[model samples]
Target chain A: GAGVSQSPSNKVTEKGKDVELRCDPISGHTALYWYRQSLGQGLEFLIYFQGNSAPDKSGLPSDRFSAERTGGSVSTLTIQRTQQEDSAVYLCASSPGLGPITQYFGPGTRLTVL
Target chain B: GESVGLHLPTLSVQEGDNSIINCAYSNSASDYFIWYKQESGKGPQFIIDIRSNMDKRQGQRVTVLLNKTVKHLSLQIAATQPGDSAVYFCAENLHSGGGADGLTFGKGTHLIIQP
Candidate 1:
């Protein structure tokens, strides 16, 4: 079966620029999540979406970060006015709707804010 | 305030030897734990998982041990191979009232296989 997929394997942008990273979850997956990983660090949760209710933005580092999942399938994470600290790999994952289910991850988009 | 952490940043084991990676978690409310492997340029792949009720679980050549009393978790790989070289992470999740939250991941341990 096809796994989760993300676009722009690598991205380089200037500080204060905005970037949009896309994610396509596996078919039939209802729960989607976005995470960030800095070099030599752990995965940091960003946001989560479950069948279109309000997304969980608790983990978003700041108000400049936002995400949207449309039609319960694809998701896009947008970082506005990116800062040097936002440089990291952005990863996307999806699961079968919750409760101890394993999440499938995408290759991720490496964002570099110069 | 709650976080998951690993004791070692790197581990080197000879091929055909066994490898053990340890993790510590601070959230007692976490009921599910998972291990993942991430190779360079790739996202994390799920390795194994165990619930709080179970102390141990086994996969093909891997075993996951959870000690809730000590908030410790370990992943043991038997006969480690070159392909096993990667960053291994331990994650904990709290299931609340049928809603699922994102996992909290440890800093990760880099496993190097020596031939």
Candidate 2:
């Protein structure tokens, strides 16, 4: 079975620029999540989407971070006016449903703020 | 804020030995926990999981032990191999969450295998 996939494995952008990262979840998976991993640190939860309900943005860190899942299959994480601190690896994961289920993660998109 | 944390930043184990990684979580309300392994330049891979109802669970060569009373968790790997060299993370479902209450992950322990 095909695993979750993300686009633009590497992205280098200047400060103040906006970058959008994309994620494609596995077929029929109803739960999707996004996390950020900084250098030498654990992954930080960013957002979560389940079915057609509202998305969870509790860990967005700032208003500059936002995400949207279209048709409950593909998701896009957009960061507005990027900052140096925004440089990290953005990973996407999807699961069969929720609650204790395993989340299969994508390769991740490394965002470098230059 | 309640969070999950690891006891060590790194651990070195010889081949064919058992490796144990420890974690402490502050959120006693958390009911589920998971262990994930991440190699260089890749996303985390789910290793195993355990629920609050059960104190222990085993998967293949990995075992997850959870002590809710003390708010601790541990991952034990038997017969460590070179392929086992990676960063191991412990994650918990905050507020029994999966829908919106995202998970909390520990800093991770980088396991170094010695031959």
Candidate 3:
């Protein structure tokens, strides 16, 4: 079966610009999550989207970071007015349902804010 | 064991030797723990997982141990190989009524395999 996939492998943008990263979870996956990883650091929780309820934005660092999972399939993470600190690897993961929390990840998009 | 803001801790081990990586989680409420292996230029790959109920679980060559008493978790790989060189991360999740809560990850440890 095809695993989770992400777009643009890499992205380079200027400061203050906005960038969008896409994620395609495996077929039938009902839960999606977005995370950020800094160099030599751990994965930081950003947002989570379940079947249909309101997304969990608690881990979002700021209002600029927003994500939307359209039709419960693909998810897009948008960073508005990006900053140097936003330069990191944006990773996406998905799970079959969610109760037990077993997730599979995508290759991720390395975003560079210059 | 665990790191704060500094760079990820490094564990150097010789090939064919057993390597054990440790993690100290902050949340005692977490009921599930997962270990992931991330190589350079790639996303994290799931290694093994353990639930709070069981103190230990084993995979092909990997074992995950969870100690709820001390809020600690450890991953032990039997007979490490060169391909095992990568960053290992321990993630914790508390089933907060919401089944799909985001995971809280530890700082991760970089494993260096030497021949």
Q: Name the best candidate (by DockQ).
A: 3
- Give the per-residue lDDT digits (tens) of candidate 3, residues A1-114: 899999989999999999999999989999888899998889987878886554467788899988888898999999999999999999999998765679899999999999
lDDT of 2 by residue, A37-103 (tens): 9999998988888874544677798999989988989999999999999999999999988777778
Report the Cα lDDT for candidate 2: 0.91
lDDT of each: 0.92, 0.91, 0.87
Poorest stretch of ten by lDDT in candidate 2 chain A: A50-59
**Pairs with backbone N, CA or C atoms under 3 Å apart (clashes), candidate 2:** none
State TM-scores per candidate.
0.97, 0.96, 0.94
Residue B24's C-alpha lDDT in candidate 1?
96
- What DockQ values do the models have? 0.64, 0.64, 0.66
How well does candidate 1 match the true structure in TM-score terms?
Answer: 0.97
Could you give the CAPRI-style class of model 1?
medium
Error in Å for residue B100 of model 3: 7.2
Task: Supply the TM-score for candidate 3.
Answer: 0.94
DockQ ranking, high to low: 3, 1, 2
Q: lDDT, candidate 1, residue A1?
A: 83
- Chain B of candidate 1 achieves a TM-score of 0.95
Compose the digit string of candidate 3's lDDT tens values, residues B6-105.
1339999999999999988867777788999999999999999998899999999999988879777899999999999999998887767644387778
Q: After superposing candidate 3, which stretches have Cα over 4 Å from the reference?
A: B1-8, B98-100
Q: Find the number of clashing residue pairs for candidate 2.
A: 0
